[model samples]
Target: MLIVGAGLTGLCTAVRLARAGLVPTVIDARRAGSGTTGHSSAKVSLLQGSMLQRLARHASTETVAAYIAANRSGQEWLLDLLRERDVPFDTRLAMTYAVTESGAKDVEAERQASRDAGLEIIDVGQGDLPFPVLDAIGLPDQAQIDPVATVRALVAELESFGGRVIEGIRMTGSSFTRPWMVSTTAGEVRAEHLVLATQAPVLDRSLDFARIKAYRSYVLAYPVADLLNVPQSMSLSLDDPTRSLRTASTGEGDFLLVGGNGHEVGHGGSTQARVDEIHAWASSHLPVDEPAWSWSAQDYHLTTQVPHIGAVPGTAERLFVATGYDKWGMALASAAGELISGDILGSAPAYAEALRAKGIRTADITETAAQGASVGGRLVGDRVRLAAPGSGQTPPGEGAGRVEGNPVRPTAVSTVDGRTCALSAVCTHLGGVVAWNDAERSWDCPLHGSRFAPDGTLIEGPATSDLEPVTE
Candidate 1:
């Protein structure tokens, strides 16, 4: 067996399959867990900040119940593995709070949905939040984890089971014949079963990417002087420009992680402004110094509000896929791993069966079509704009980038840290025009979330290759 990603979903699935007497080879385009899994907030909780309420809008009560069941099983499985491996994680209350009246209504709806899903959520009207809130809800004994540590433990477990892990291997193509062949940058490898546990499946055969929309968000960690005063709960805000708070202990000292201000991958302008917004909020509310570290993360979400985990639509049960966690990947990834492995080993738990039983709804299809139309609009509009550009050679100012040239071929130019680079502005995934992300100093695709470094190195998303270098 072969897995095409080495994040939590891929590694967990690989480890489980290995324990069941199958040696799976897990490969990653980058280092293991260096993608979304590493950059995640790593809050494992059932009270997922208005998620249940949003899901109830498009799904039946039974489907929501099954979804919660699957997530519960996933959480238990992860906690057990962490305990067995001696990985240290903190148990804290996971709270969802709202400051505005509209947000309060959403939280009330979420509270009702939580009850319907059988979660023991408590209504904490105005909790220990620094600011005033209209409403607050929490589930006690939820978990917060160091994502990097969790990945390391999983890697060790997989290796102990005689599973091989290879990094820096990009999957170029695949042939789903008997003994399926996967073409990577390293070489072609054949396996009977293949699992795509990537954030977004690289393959487009099943149109899974079409069913989901990609979003990018930022996280900033600040060194805190008064850890005692900091909220002990892993908390999220149910309002626009969402605010997520959780404390962390690192080698340097304790810190507060503030995350949110999310937008579509490349549509939102001035990514730096989003970071500024976070900084402004932290400065106003938290007793923290300058940010010690900051980074951006990308995730995909289905309108149906449930992750898709099963055989690819037409792969004859040979190709498995798991994606669309909707920013709550910590436990869902584990659940996805178990479900996919169970499908292969024929011992999938009852929750896995329940999740599979949940079918797609018409609302989901309509949303998917709407997202597709938006992507189409971006492609046509961006191409037309790029076609009306000026000279392609002039270098951009430091820390800036621009797309220049004619309609037939556009060149992306960026200068960062006193260096400059030029590459094709076209995304390798589906020819979407790449836009510069001022915050991360990278080119991002507006179509399917593919992102690239300043020199055009493929960072993540469904793109299979780096942006081509532009010749004079």
Candidate 2:
């Protein structure tokens, strides 16, 4: 077995495979836990964001029950593993709250759906939270783990089980024979089975990439002296602009992770603004001297809210993928690994039906259409505003100029200083027209937080990669 990533999903799958008498080889572009998995908020709860009702609408009762059961079981399995391995984790009950009074209906619907699905749910009125909450539903036995520690433990076990983990190896692409072939920068790895668990599937072009929208969320860790009063529960808000809070113990003191400010990848505002907002919210909630760590993470959200697991659609016996956890990767990743491993081992999994079922399509056609409009709009808009190039006047920057045949289309040019520059005025992360930030000397994504240097290097990310340079 060959796993393309070394994150939670890949590591879990590797461990399972090894236990099942197969020594899987796991390879990562970077070191283990360097990807999205390491940066995750690491909430392991079955009470995902309004997902029960959504699952009830589309799936059968049995499927829904299996779905719930799988995640609940996964949580327990993780807890048992941690206990047996002596890995320190926070195993606490999780209460997902509906912030707005209007969200009461949705909360009720979710509770009912969970009940129907044979899962336990408790309603909280007062004294359940450190601060006042509108209404909250508590799910018993939900857990929170240090994702990095969990991955390290898993990796250690994997090594003990004779599984191989090779880091600093980048998989450029793949080729298929009877068994699939994975081509990495290090070497060629041929395996009877291949799993693409690399957050986003780098293979399989037929799969709708747009179906899962990527979102970047910010987290601020603060040390507060008063720890006992702070609830040891994981929480999520049901409001439009949602926020989540979880607490963890550190060597310094007890730290509260205040997370929110999510927006589509490459489509948010200043990164600093989002970080500051989270910090401010955390400060208001508790007394904080300074943020222990401030970082951002991107998650792929499926339209259906349930994770897409199992074989790649329309293919059999070869390639598989698991993605779109939607911030529920802790449980979802484990569930997905179990399902995929079962399929590999020729065993029937309880959650297979739910994993194989087609998910709700949430492609942003409007966003795509708007992008088309902006590209065309900017070309025409810029032409009318600025005069044609003259003898002495150069373009705005190194590559900021009109193409010869098509004056509207801009092209990126390389400056003598070895910087590749783009001519497009509109920031691709979001449709906000990017203005040059003189102080930073970069193009900032105004709608969501993404920054690009003058040469188009991604300085700060919510945007994973740099903007595509405009070509003639």
lDDT at position 36, candidate 2 = 75
Top model number, TM-score: 1
The list of candidate 2 runs beyond 4 A from truth reads: 358-472
The whole-model lDDT of each prediction reads 0.88, 0.68
Lowest-sum lDDT 10-residue window in model 2: 398-407
Alpha-carbon shift of residue 3 in model 1 (angstroms)? 0.8
Candidate 2 — which pairs collide? 266-429, 268-447, 268-448, 268-449, 269-447, 269-448, 269-449
* Global lDDT of model 1: 0.88
lDDT computed for candidate 2: 0.68
- Evaluated at residue 379, the lDDT of candidate 1 is 83
**Which ranges in model 1 have alpha carbons more than 4 Å from their true place?**
360-362
Per-model TM-score versus the true fold: 0.97, 0.80
lDDT of 2 by residue, 12-110 (tens): 888888888899999987789887788888888888868788767655676677778778767777777778788898767777677577676677788
- Could you tally the backbone clashes for each prediction? 0, 7
> How far in Å is the alpha carbon of 220 misplaced in model 2?
0.3
